[model samples]
Target: MTQPNTLPQVQPSTTAIHAGYTPSGDYRPLTVPLYSSAAYEFGSHAEAVEKFALRASGFTYSRTGNPTVSVFEQRAAALEGGANAVATATGQAAVALSLLALTQGPKHIIASSQLYGGTVDLLTDSFNDFGIRITFVDPDQPAAWEAAIEEDTRAFFLESVTNPLSTLPDLPALAEVAHRHNIPVVVDNTLATPANFKPLAYGADIVVHSATKALAGHGQVLGGVVVDSGTFDFSDEARWPQIARARERYAGTSLLARYAGGAYSMLVRSKFLHDLGPTLPAANAHSIITGIETLPVRTAAAQSTLLLLANFLEAHPLVKAVHHPSRTTHRHHERAAKFFPRGTGSVLAVELHDADLVPAFIDNLKIIALAANIGDTRTMIAHPATMTHCRLTPSQLAEAGLNAGVLRISVGLEDPADLIRDLDRALAAAEVSGDKSTVKDVVFA
Candidate 1:
């Protein structure tokens, strides 16, 4: 088998389809075959020991590793220009495990104020229970991140393109601030997949994704991945003892010593996933691998449709505001243009004239499905105030630039004309219903 790293570097579109798999000899399958076995047999006891000691590269158990999942990992790592990758059962697990592995105890993390509600919950609720402290800072202000950093700060986290609002931060600037403090910048690239932006290329230390979204473009599987840029110096034993210091757990070998460039990803796989057991299934890995083959084309089409819809909505009298970086009215337009030249992505948020019109507007849409998930072949719309961002307090919502009058739309692989027509009808219906005092706030079942 040819290593993904050894394969000649190529364009992203070509790499998406042919990075990890290389069939040779008698069994030359055109596609990557699924290996569903829970365990693999070793040729001899010596070989088993060697594999267990990380001296050889082979899978022993599905919980820790699988051949099918490895292919997906390698492909993703190559696409992100990372040293390696680790796949998790869900995007939430990926976020949790990545942060958890970075710190052993009572550490601090500085995160962007405009992040996914689920991530906010994970940091403020779950990680708080574990004694980790998190401080939210406005991504627009690079100095805020610097001011919030302390000696115990382990990582700096932010979304590449913030959820719902489509806010694009100055990633390179924020990363520089974090790097100066010897902190790794962990970016959630779920919204802006590698097709549109590569966070690592812009100075980010780590990149993670909810592969459930754009990577698995059809929305059939749930998965996430963490990729390490292989540049962060983990040899600082005082700050990152897990990677730098020798431990008795794995034969007293430090990860940084064993895998010089891939310490972060290697530790995530061998320690975090090994103990936590949030393993990605072989079948799901195969499905995500297939979805990635068409990511560039799928994302491009949907992004184009999204820009058209955003423009149309902006022109409508009913829409109070449209929150997309592609719009000139957006504060982050220049930064977005510099980073995401392709498009801001398929997701955009629009604020209506009144909050009461949301339910009626969403219910009236015949073509767009009402769902929380994004990056699908079909269009999806959701009320962020009640759906994805409900966990946030009023002040937090305002800080994140989300409100009750705002609605998020994830454009899909549909014709712009048909989508525009459907949205036009829905908006008309909503306007009519908004005029009536008897209108209710209940969403359609």
Candidate 2:
């Protein structure tokens, strides 16, 4: 077999489909082969010893690695321009492992206030119980980010394109702040896949993706990956004492010292993944690999549909405002062009003129599914105020830019005219069902 190229030197469109694995056998299978083996037979006890001792590079356990999954990891790493990647059961696991590997008890983390609701709970409610404290900042305000950092802060977390509202943070500026403090910036690049954006290229130390989204464009697989650039200098004892202390646990070698370019990802696979076990199934890996092949084509089509949807909602009588990063009205429009120049992605938020009518409006939609999932081949819509962010307090939701009537939409590869017509029918019916007192609130200026 030819050695796989570790660097993301190929063009993204080509890399997405071909960077990871080469066809095997005389027939040259066009797709990666699914190696559904739990364990590999060793030549002898001596060969097994070397593999177990980390002295030789070879897979021993499916949990540790597999060929099919390796292809997915390598393909993701290449597309994101990272040195290496670790595939997980879901996007949430990817977030958990990145934080677990990067931090210890009593450590501090800084995150954006406007984030996926699941993330808010994971950081504020879950990790807090583990003795790790987190500070939520407005990513829109660069000063707030700087102010939130403390001496014990180990990582800075945020999304490239946020979930509820489509906001783009200034990745370079935020990364500079974290780097100056010797902290790693871990970005959730789920919304804007590598086709549109690569967080590592823009200065993120680690990039995590919900492969369940655009990477698995059809939404057929529930998976995620954490990619490491191997750029951060974790060996600087003055800067990263935890890394130095944890060396003995990872075969007596500091992760940063042993693996220069993909140290963090290696650590994640070897440590957290090996122990916690959110490993992806070989079958799921095969499904996602197939989904990745057409990512460029799917994303381009989705973006075009999203633009039409956003425009339609903006002009609709029942939509108060539309939130999309590319729109000049958005506070982060300039940042979006700089970071996600390919496009702002297919997800956007629409504020209803009347809060009470959103429920009826959603029920009336025929083509758009009422689902929380994003980046599917079929359009999905959700009311953030009630579904995704309901756990947050009113004040918290307000801070996160979520209004009571705000609705989120993930456009898909459907005919733009049909999507618009479905939405139009829903909005018209919603206007009639809404309370007369609240009718004015649902209409745009």
Candidate 3:
């Protein structure tokens, strides 16, 4: 047997590439094997009962747990410096499940005003219908979070770095406020990814990711993960009833009592994950796992390219403003330096001088594709007011810095010179349309 002391602790870069799987058998695979079976056979009836009861850790069904997904979850947890993690079918599912695990009905959540549009829809529509109350506060304001807190507030949620706009939330300050109020902080680190930042390192209690974006690197797979730091004091049973109090899911034993240091994730896996039926497929898990291996190198290059593009765009005559943390004029410039020393992940929002010429600009793009997804190997662009953030109200749009003239660009591994040429062409087209008598303004819902 290989002793634990035989190897020293590895770094995040090494962990991202190789953490979950180990080769031992005569004909072992070098990577995580895809376990596509719907269910697993138990060695004996006694073992089955133990597994079913959550006493023994073994997969009985893929819906709640699978070998491949488990590896992805574990690696994700390790990257985020979490106690454990749970994988879900989609990023939305992971966000929903994380909150659902905290509160049932008629509870409250304090979320950031800078969240993605779909998340806003979920909070205002589905969660409202489910009897959960949510108060959205500007992520920059720590006082707003404290003022919005309620006795029944279960969790505080925000993005480490926001979508469309690369806004940085003061994670440590927000975490301090949430902890003072006895609420746990849940951060969506999708945009930044662990490549640029890990929320747990800055005082976040739980971290969630849209693995579809950067973790999968390629846009081929869709998955999500929830990683808990295990540092939250769930001993306050009155506040965290699901974790501290007895539950029927694990045969009436409390998750905290059953799975010490991993109760939050255990509850998410055994209950919210089981009931919601958003099981991530083994193939998707495998894809995300493999994609994560190249995260560090991919992000390092892409972010450097993005910074150059951002500087170029900012100096352009047709450009109104550039929203990126690395820019010294940006609100979060110092915050980015403090938190994201490696570089902020390769996404930026640029405001054009003419909103009326947006269509001409979008139509002229050649290499940079017009797509809604980010963290891809291909540079993509989307107008937030007409695309991703279309549903956001005018006030919400203003708060998120999503004006009609702003374009969200996801920088990829493409050559910086080629991307610059494409941008130059697009901007020139927009200028030509402005010269004409006929104006073309993009419309949205």
Candidate 4:
């Protein structure tokens, strides 16, 4: 292991390329070689025992570790300015494992109401079976989070930039509140990739990503990662007994004592991942690594295109409202600008004059594809009210600022003119089908 004092600080772009792997002197492989074997061979019986004991650095089973996945994990950690990272089968698993690792017993979690629908389901439905309680609060109000936190509150969760609406939370202020209560802040940076935002840099304790999205940059892979900033002190036994207490399964070793700077990552990998077995495949890790190499360039182009499209749609007669932080009219515009000066992100939501026209508008688009996923090379659109946020109740939808007319667009690396023309034609088609009798009460502001 490289000593912390000897570690070199490099730019994210540089870290993406070279932080994880180095060619062996004999083989001189330029890329991270994929190890497909299910189990690695041990030189001796004693060596196998040592590997199982976690006394040696080597892979024993693919479910636990692999060379390619490790490279991806290391690179992701470096890019996010984290001490370590654990790759998982999907983004949802990353969120689940991170939270589960923190709370093994009955505990409380304060989460932003504006989370991804899938995440909302996990917290409310699935995790409730395990005696974990979640309290959802508005991301815009820091005081709400303060009031909602309880004695058992272990973590505060929110997205850096919300999924469809692009809402920005005061991360630094929230992190301060969480720290004051001895709780860690976990930020999901899937929408605002590390290329655009590093949550840890803004006082976030941990960062999570759906590598299937922007991190992979292509819609071809399914993966997720949990990164530990290594700044949160898990030595507080009362707050985080999972890390501070001795574990019988792992030879009675306390994770915090065993891995001081990387207690969170170590616990997640050794405990949750070991039992749950949500492993990222070696091939998928390779694809994500390749996708990450071009993330900066891809995200920049997509972000610029998103801004142009948002502006175009905001001025259009058929559009009722545009929800993007880049637009000055957005409620969180200033906060978004303060955190993400490079760009708010590639995703934006726009409301049409008629809720009934959403299907037609989506059906008429020629270039943009209709899909549930985001952060792809091709522009993608989805109706959040029916798709991503469908799980939420009617009241939840209203609180989230989503309506039946809202369309979520994930901008891609395409010509701005081509995308604009596609949307213009689609809007014209949608307008033709609109009921003139129902248009009187529709507000365009």
User: Using TM-score as the measure, which candidate wins?
Assistant: 1
**Global fold similarity of model 4 (TM-score):** 0.95
Instruction: Give the TM-score (vs. native) of candidate 2.
Output: 0.94
Q: Which lDDT tens digits does candidate 4 get at residues 1-445?
A: 1111223877667776787887774677777777777788899999999989987878889888888898899889888988899999999999999898877777999999898889988998998989999999999899999999888899999999998899999999999999998899999999999988999999899899999999899999899999999989888887788888888876898888888978889889877888889999999999999998888888889998988898899999989999988888889888877889888668999988778788778888999999999999999999887888787877777777777788899999999999999999999988887634332233322
Residue range 1-445, candidate 2, lDDT tens digits: 3236444456777887788877666877777887888889999999999888777888899998988898998899888888889999999999999988887756899998988888888888889999899988888777788888888899999999899688888888899988888889999999988899989988899999888988897877799999988788787765565465456666776766666666777778888899899999989989999898888888889998888888888998878999997678998888777767788677989998778887789888999999989989999999876777767776778788888678899999889999999999999987888644442243222
Q: State the C-alpha lDDT per candidate.
A: 0.89, 0.84, 0.87, 0.87
Of models 3 and 4, which has the larger TM-score?
A: 3
Looking at model 4, the pairs that clash are none
Poorest 10 consecutive residues by lDDT, candidate 4: 436-445
In candidate 3, the residue pairs with backbone N, CA or C atoms under 3 Å apart (3 or more residues apart, or in different chains) clash, namely none
Clashes of each: 0, 4, 0, 0
Which ranges of candidate 3 are over 4 A from the true structure? 1-7, 435-445
Off by over 4 Å in 2: 1-9, 238-242, 435-445
Alpha-carbon error at 232 in model 1, in Å? 0.2
Q: Arrange candidates by TM-score, highest first: which order?
A: 1, 3, 4, 2
lDDT of 1: 0.89
1 against 4, candidate with superior TM-score = 1
**Positional deviation of residue 20's Cα in model 1 after best superposition, in angstroms:** 1.0
lDDT of 3 by residue, 297-335 (tens): 888988999988998999999999999998999999998
After the best TM-score superposition of candidate 3, give how far the Cα of residue 207 lies from its true spot, in angstroms. Answer: 0.2
Give the winner by lDDT.
Answer: 1
Candidate 2: count the clashes: 4
